[model samples]
Each structure stands twice: as structure tokens, then as C-alpha cells.
Target: MPSTLPSASPGTLQLQPDAGAVHLRVAGDWTLAHYRHLRQAVERARAPLAADSEIDLSALGALDTAGAGLLAELIGPARLAQVGRWAPGLPAERLALLGTVAQALDQPPAELPRAGWGLADLLAHIGRSVQNLWRQQKQLLGFIGLTLQTLAVTLPRPWRWRVTSLAAHLEATGLNAVPIVALLTFLVGAVVAFLGATVLAEFGASVYTVNLVGFAFLREFGVLLAAILLAGRSASAFAAQIGSMKAQEEIDAIRTLGLSPVELLVLPRVLAMLIALPALTFVGMLCGLAGGLVVCALTLDISPLMYLTILQRDIALSHFLVGLGKAPVFAFVIAVIGCLEGFKVGGSAQSVGEHTTSSVVQSIFMVILLDAIAAMFFMEMGW
Candidate 1:
């Protein structure tokens, strides 16, 4: 029996110096089995070749992408492209593979031009931001229309009402929230009275502090404070709750069953909030007036009767009506925004958390914006 002699390593490279030019005789199973050895072999044999250097693939063996890539790197891209002329004995498919890899490696990558903070860049950024905001607002308006349509369809049929869910949400949104809304407005009312008394004392009109507190609370603070609180609490809760359901694909299941998610999930919450906010606002106004009365009695030596007398004389019924009137609008916007963000949730806890935060921010911002516009309108009307 003849000895194996280790059979020349599957991949082989031989460098020949010919007439001051180079001829590379390559041979072997250059597939990935010998990838490491082939790489090292190519690295060591990668000497600078004359422009006219030639490669001989006549003795080459089996090839693959990994092996062909190595061959392309070793032979130089310039010579690799014209392989048909240099190695006619090379298989066409292998020739095509080598040519493809060579072409790919030879070209420089294309890239976007880097931009600086110049006027053009600034304008472009502003344009993009405006476009995004417009798109978002359009979507919100469309969702509002959809919710109203769902409400219209669901309203005539009392059979479609989710009485239990509405009552539960009302308990949470209105009854459970009463203590905080009351306490917050009460404290603010007392502070306003103190400030008014301090400022009016110089004019011997400390009694006017009663009127001041009533006007501020009745006209602005009571409703504004409650809406802000709910925007933070209820809006975020709504987003998180529905977002979780969405992430679990429950909304999709409801749709698959030929039921409307907007009608089922959104209407109960919206109606509940609409009914709850005005009631909360009224509660806020009473607590605020009570707080002011306490402050006037203790600090200004004014009795509760006198404070009430002044409030009756100076604070018009129109002011209270104006404040209470804003609540339903605020409530509807908050609920709609929260539910919209929930519907937008992707399938992840991170998405739920993110949409919850976005809902709160959007609800509060809309509340403030609407409040300002309402204030201006009422002021102009002398309401």
C-alpha cells in the first residue's frame, strides 16, 4: 500500500516570478472547509504585483462564495473582471461568481451627504415637524369623527349601552377622584384669598379678597385644575389599559368577531367622563369657595356670612356657568386622545408605556389650549 503523504492541503497557492511580471498558479478545493487556511495563505502571498500580473485558474479546484471571495482578493479586481480572456478553462459559473464578488468589492459605497445646522437644514427640519404635526392632527380629527359616528349609531338603542362599565368608570373618574380635586382647589382658593387680602389691606379693602377668590375659582381655577388632574390620571390609565389589551391582540379579536372596538371600548368611557367632569367641576367650585371662606374668617377677621354676601354681590352666575361649561369638552378630548393612543399601541410593554405617556401629554396640552381659547371667547363676549 502507498502512503497517503497527507495529500497536498486541499487549497494551494504558488507564486512564480516570470520575466519581471507575476504568474499565480492557484489550485485546490477552495471551499469553506479550508477557509481559515486559505485566508492565511492569501494573506501571506499578497505581494505587490506588476500591473500586467496574471492568474492561472486552469489548475483550480472546487469553489464557493467564501473561496471565490478569497480568489478575487488575491488576484486583484482589475484582473478578476477580465477572467474570460485570462482563464478560458475556468467554469463559466465560477467565473460569474468571482466576477460578481470582484465588482462588488471594487466599488465604493454610496452615502447620504452629511448636513450641518445651516438655514437650509433648519428650514427642512421645520417643514418635517410641521408635516408630522399636521398628519397627527388630521388623524385625531378623523378619530373624533369616528367616535361621534359610533356614538350616534349606539345612542338610539339603549340596548347597546354598557351600563355596568359606565358606572364603574364613573365611580373611578368621578367619585373616587373627589377627595383630591376638592383638596387641591381648596388649598389654591385659600392661597388666592391670602394673596388678595395682603394686596388689598393697603387700600383697606381686605374684604374684597372674598370676591377675588370667588371670581378666580368660579371663572378659571376650579375647572382648569380638575381637567389637568384627570389628564394626568385618567388619560394615562385609559391609554395603559387599552394599550395592554391591544398589545395582547384583544382588539383584533373583537374586530374579528364583527364587533366594533371603538363602540365597545370608547363610548362607555367617553359618556362616563362627559357626565363626571361637570359634576367634579361643581364640586371643585364649592370646595374652593369654602376654602376662601375659611381663610377670610381666620386671617381677615371677616365672617362667613359677610364673605357669602360679597360673593353673592360680585360673582355672577355666568362665571360659574362658563367654568362648568368647559368640562364636557375637556373630558371628551381627554378620553378620545387616550383611547386613540391606546389604539396606536404596538405589541410590546414598551409601546404601551410610551403611548400612555403620549396620551397624558396630548390631553393636557389640548385642555390648556382649549381653555385659553374659551377664555378669550368668553372675555370678548363679557360672559
Candidate 2:
């Protein structure tokens, strides 16, 4: 008899080969561990074996499904040329064990599924943005309502502070703007006169230069230039002032002190712009006309009286009224946008500077856009 097989425990390795068979024994609580070792040993032994090979597990005392399946896998490749057998074996159970391990090894890896966004999700996002914008619009309307109420109450008061402040703002926005406005207006008038004289002098119609300059400045250039000037000056000033207050938490402090920032700070500025812009536009128009008059008298020898006569004959009251009418609306728009942006300023000096610059740029763009729309409407109305 072969040397009496020694009692072995789980994970013990034993290899025995006879003339025609290999008897690999796995003993005691046989598991996948025993199966793997046994399979590896057989593979090593098979390299030198004939095409025929045999595996016998006759003395296996206890074996798990895992161990049983690994044994089947070792036998599978040699099934045609060799025989596979188990002692004290249950065939059906062994088959089931092999199937479980095969299925587990063949299965794909687990993964998380992806969720996709569709049109409905996009629509929901847009709806949310619109709702937020609607709330802001309501808040702006409320500010306007409160302003109207305050103005109603304040107008009846015997205080001269309002008028005095208006006068000061008028000087600041108007008087201070005079030199640059005059300079630019003069240049513009000179250019217009040059272009008009160049073209009209060909036909001995140089006298028409006065009419072109006068009517153009009175009707459009004066108001447009005035609006652009205030957009740069007052709009930026308002944004910077409010932005600084916001950065410093001064607006909050005013609220804490039972004061209305709108009344104390914002309203005065708004009123100032409203009063100042019209006066500035009026001054700008006069300066522009005077400029054209100088160019005409100096270069074209057109008399001042003749230029005034043409202005009276060609420029209508409706043109003057339309230009003046746009001033207050432009003022209101610049004031509201500048203050709103300032109120939104965060606690950074950079944010204050950014919003101040943005207020001026955005107000100027809006002023031009609104002017274009107004021009279309007035044209449609045959103004």
C-alpha cells in the first residue's frame, strides 16, 4: 500500500502521480483555496504529460461548491482524452457548483447609470430664471411707488432744501459740463459746416450750410450729445457713490438708524439728474448753435441774422419738444439703473469700481437704444 495518507488540514498541498494518473488530494475543509492550488499543481504537471490525463478526488472528506467547481474546470479541457471522477461524489451537486462559479466569473463589472437632461428640464430652468426676474421687477416697481408717495409728501413741505439741492445739482451737472460740451459742439459744428460747404459750394449753394447745421443740431445732435455726456458723468457718479456706500455697509447702517437710503441718498440724486439733464441739454443746444454760427460767419460769411431766420423757418416746435421730452426719461433711466447696480454691489472695492464703470457703459447703451426706438415711434407718428 502506498504510504498511509497523512491527515492534512485545509490549504495543505499534496501531489502524487502514477504511471497513468495523477491523484491530487485536498484534505480537510476543502475550499476555493484548495481548488486553486490543486489546479495550479496539475497545470504544472500537465506540461510533461501525454494528451491523456486523469484527476481523481477519491478521499476528499469535505468540500465546498467553490472547490468542487474549480475541480471541474481542471477536468474540462481534458474531458475528451481523459476521465474525471469523484469518490463519495454527488454528480448533480457538482454540476450546480461549476455553473455558479462560471456565471460569476463571466459576469460584467457593476457600473452607475447616467441620467440625461431633456427639453423639460431646460424649460424648468428657464421658468425659474423668469420667476426670479419677475421678483426683481416687482421690487423695482415698489421702489417707484414709494418714490412717488415720498415726492407727494415732500412737495408740500415749506423746506427750501429740495430747491437748493436741485440748484446745486444743476450747477454740478450743467455748469461743470459747459467747457467740454462747448469744445465738442464747436468741433462738430465746424465739421458739419466743412462737409456741407464742400458739397454745396459746388452748386453755389453754400448758404444752405447754415440751414443744415442749424436744423441738425437743434433737432438731434444737441439732445444726443447731451444725453451721452450725462450718461458718462452722472450715471457713473451715481453708481460710484452708491457702490461705495454698499461696500462700506453705509446703506445698511442708514437702515439700522431708521433712515431711508432712497430718500436721503438716491432720491436727491435722481431729482438732481432729472432737473439737471434738461438744463444741460438746453445749454448744449445754445452752445452748439453759437458754434455753428461762428463757423458760418468766419468761413462761409453767412450772417448770424440769416442763420437765425433759417433756424426759425425750418426747425419746428415739435422737434425741440421731442428732444427735450427725451431728457427726463433718459435721466430717469440712468438714475434707476445706476442706483440699482450700486445697491447690488458687494463688499469689495473692486466690485464698486466694476459696477460704477458698468453703470456708465450700460446707461449709455440703453440711452442710444431708447433713442433709436423713440425715433422710430416718432417717425411712425409723422413727427
Find the candidate with the highest lDDT and give its number: 1
Kindly report which residue pairs in candidate 1 clash with one another. none
lDDT of 2 by residue, 92-161 (tens): 5644555566565556789975478789888988999999879866765676677767667766775624
List residue ranges in candidate 1 displaced over 4 A: 1-11, 17-22, 27-70, 76-107, 110-115
Report the alpha-carbon TM-score of model 2 versus the true structure. Answer: 0.61
Task: After the best TM-score superposition of candidate 1, give how far the Cα of residue 300 lies from its true spot, in angstroms.
Answer: 0.8
For each candidate in the order shown, give its overall lDDT on alpha carbons: 0.89, 0.72
- Alpha carbon deviation, residue 81, candidate 2 (Å): 53
Model 1, 1-383: lDDT tens digits are 96533335488998898888887789887887788899998998887555677777888887889898888788777678878877887888988988898888888889978866888888999999999889989989999999999999999999999999999999988899999999999999999889999999999999889888988889899999999999998989889989999999999999999999998899988998999889989989999989899999999999988888888988889998999999999999999999999999999999999999999999999999999999999989878
Give lDDT: candidate 1, residue 67: 90
Error of 2 at 153 (Å): 4.1
